[model samples]
Target: MQPTMEFLTSEEAIQVDAALLSSKEKFSTRLAIYALRCLKQIAAEKEISVEAVTAQQVSDWIKKDENIQQQLELDSNFELFFTRLVLSSLKPLKQIAQSEQQPIENLTLKQVVSWFEQESKIRQE
Candidate 1:
């Protein structure tokens, strides 16, 4: 699987404040940011591109994280559910990275939040 990734950077947290997302969108953006970090780490360690990282790799990485390990001890279901949540986020993160022609780790919070906002509008249409 992937590796441990920070949920938010100080700069990202600040940008999130400027985005004016709904609660659910905010949650998704945060998760996507975390996923990008995981993907970057996995790609670097595996000597591959970020888009080449597999879901299984990410799942394994999550399982190894100390925080996730603690949660796993308390509930097997949390591991499965959280793993899925993180895996689900990879698609959009990759898309944004691809569209921006940049490495996943280089994507800024403004870019991510703006992409989600555009997507929300598209879905509404």
Candidate 2:
């Protein structure tokens, strides 16, 4: 029989965020946000607090010292998935910029999202 996974509570999840924030890895703000989103999803599935999965832990498992080429080789789908997530997350930010009458080129949010999309496409090949 398979063992059931144990879940952490909400309080525990907050701890995870702290751990992630303390990691040496210099995750881009958007990447960090994506990681947090993934952590929350994982936590929900496991019925645990998001805190149980620290940023450091995620950094260790997924981000630390890993080359993009290596990651693409490991999972061809990763680039696509990451790009989609980034683009989706950026939509609202883009809308906000537009609403504020800000120039899209000057918007960090738009630039980052465009960068992710372009990088993803290049990596996928």
Top candidate, metric lDDT: 1
Pairs with steric clashes in candidate 2: 8-48, 8-49, 12-51, 13-50, 13-51, 16-51, 20-55, 20-56
Alpha-carbon RMSD, each predicted model: 4.8, 16.4
* Candidate number achieving the greatest TM-score relative to the actual structure: 1
Q: Provide the overall lDDT of each model, using Cα atoms, as 2-decimal numbers.
A: 0.78, 0.44
Off by over 4 Å in 2: 1-29, 32-67, 108-125
Give lDDT for model 1.
Answer: 0.78
**Model 2 per-residue lDDT at 88:** 49
lDDT of model 1 at residue 39? 76
